[model samples]
Target: MIEPQPTRRRPAADVQHAVERMRELARALPARDGIAVFNRVYLTVTEEVVRRSADGLFRDPLASAELSARFAERYLSAVEVAAGGHRPPACWRPLFQLRRHPGVRPLQFALAGINAHIGHDLALSVVDTCTARGCEPAEVEGDFERVGQVLTALEERIREDLMPGPDLLDIADPLTHLLGAWSLERARDAAWAAARVLWRLRDLPEVYGEFIEGVDSSVGMVGRCLLTPLG
Candidate 1:
């Protein structure tokens, strides 16, 4: 049975809380578990955001913290939904469905998770942050951009570290072809565009519902493609 979500949406407690949540999740999952792979990637980025915020990196630390926490909450919430034996959103189903498939590489799991999060969760998170802060999406754009920069930088490191060497996966491998098809920059750009669209549709609840359904299914489709295994 699916557990009901809270009626009122709230900002996650804070960025450190998000860090702790991901940490606990990582500890619970097996070392090479696909979800764990993605969890570690996200946790590292959250920890960095905490470090940079302490160093006074963001223009508005408090708002940035809230934004980051809110973003993490979406992923965490999806985890909870699945943990309770209910289906997660369409955007999240591919990773959960394929997490244990031995044929799929860790890098594939990690990227598929990112595809779902960045492609779907991100735009919703922007709207989530704006609503929680009682501001418009435009007002919240700075923090969003800063968080994106943090994610973009960490993603490069993740790719370098997680990618198999050419000896293991040759240039002609299907994995190589799959990797070439997706771009983090393009996903981020599309997310920003979706965020603005969602913001505009906020008043029309039915329209917003239909629009996000498309985003969820489309992102999930890409995630499925990312998880396809090859020899």
Candidate 2:
């Protein structure tokens, strides 16, 4: 007969104290440092949302709606930075390229595919929000057109500079194949779809807030995970 192993005791107090320390660190972070924190949070939250959504978190229509709304908020946040008016944190470039890493590439491609599929849904959400609030379609479309141009340029630059070269051509080929399999023409399709949704949902402040909060929370979590680990 084998001796029984001791069960691990829970350390709730230690966990709570650790959390408090993390919060303090987050609070003390400078704005530049905060960007990396937020980006990490965004990535974590989005990945969780994607996983959960696929695992039937969206079985409830309301939860599904909330997830979609959150996605829109996160995408818009990134788009805002890409629009040239605001500079996104430097970490964004590397974080975005993390998708290309061998360990994380599959998930990155999945996100790219999802982005392509849901881009219109996001755009429509925005459009709907604006219209309900008395904004004209033309105005929303104009803003989207301008923003879309900037985003396109940014994506192109990323592909050229960060995406792997011919040595990694095999990986690129498979990715391209996967994109075709998914019937996605490009990642830009997702951006376009999001703009369409925004036009449609521009006036639903409550929905918008839910979306924004999800993103904010996600960002917070990511920051804590990435930065606190360093500390």
Candidate 3:
């Protein structure tokens, strides 16, 4: 006779608990504080992406040292902006120079995609709440649509920038393993960091309701997509 097998643990229970906690947090937030909270969260996520990319890109001894230095400076400036301030000395100019470097282009494209997604989310959330509250719906819709268009354009630009040429596969082969692992880790951390920042916005009364409602609605939509029975 065979010995009884140990039962397998279900991870879904943990996920469900996390989701429930998120819903509770969403419900606890007040209405007016959403936009600021979202902006801060979005900025935090973007800054993390930039920081990780900078670190990874600079680790290449063969890469442009000046470019890395400029990127670090720009990243710091962006961090300042994220901290409720302006970019020092126009850091975006130096940051844009990364696009010119073949080695740095892939990371730039990835960061652009991440920023576009964040902007799209923020714009749509604003539009959703404005419409829900019967406040300047048409203007908000137009702005939201424009933001979506901009996001689409940025996505296309990034795709074109990142398209590998004939020699790219060979050049990338050496660093592929390391870059892949780092990018995945960074993306995961960025997403969670963003979520935590948004969660903290629950304390700010002015943006709290909108943030909670927007997040709750987003979560609900995701849940519906996941929980719907296969047709």
Candidate 4:
């Protein structure tokens, strides 16, 4: 009798497939739609993660892959929850709620989603990854920081690519200032801090859950502000 082989999870490969699926979906949607804009940004980030993972650039490839997958899962789950007619986290509520509003520009939509994901989802995802692997955040902090760097670099590109023409860079463009107020670096730092706090409170499930919920809702409020339409 042949021995049964243990199953392995290819986290990077899974992200690649998910990115491709999202890319196709974005292509099928109207370009100006808010969700499509964020989808494009997210797809680009996933592609970069997959590429870097393939090059063995991470300090711990397995942990990196797991962390990335867990991070992406949070975003995807929010989508499913909203699609099922249930509200997602407060951070996510803004994007899903205003995703189709004519007054909200694509740039606002993209940035709002980035704000929510980085501020709330990333921290929880860190906790989830640590729980799954029975390890400490310090063990995977390198991967987390590297991923943050990638997102920060990509965020610059997003601003340049999506911002209105040079003539509109003045105060007349409320979107410019609104997006500028949120920084990926700040969000990343806060996320790490939140992760540590959550981990410390983990033994108290009720407290841990409430902390996570508070983070989620507070981040959502910021997202709502970011997505506020400028007419």
Stretches > 4 Å off in candidate 3: 1-78, 81-105, 116-134, 164-231
lDDT of 1 at 96: 96
Model 2's alpha-carbon lDDT is 0.40
Against the true structure, candidate 2 reaches a TM-score of 0.34
Displacement of residue 2 (Cα, Å) in model 1 is: 30
Residue 20's lDDT in candidate 1 = 88
Write down the lDDT of every candidate, Cα atoms only. 0.86, 0.40, 0.35, 0.85
**Candidate 2, 49-149: lDDT as tens digits:** 44444565433423233323433454445535644656433323333333323343322333342342243334444454454445554444443443344
Question: Candidate 2, residue 190: CA error in Å?
Answer: 7.7
Ten contiguous residues with the weakest lDDT in model 2: 222-231
lDDT by residue (47-75, candidate 1, tens digit) is 98888888878876767777788788899
Give candidate 2's error at residue 57 in angstroms: 39
| Best model per TM-score | 4
**How accurate locally is residue 135 in candidate 3, as Cα lDDT from 0 to 100?**
54
lDDT of 3: 0.35
lDDT per residue as tens, model 3, 119-147: 22333333334433445434333333333
Residue 168's lDDT in candidate 4: 50
Q: Model 2 has how many clashing residue pairs?
A: 36
Which parts of model 4 have CA positions greater than 4 angstroms off? 1-8, 166-168
CA error at residue 213 for candidate 3, angstroms: 13
| Full ranking by lDDT | 1, 4, 2, 3
> Which has the higher lDDT value, candidate number 1 or candidate number 4?
1
What lDDT is reached at residue 39 by model 2? 35
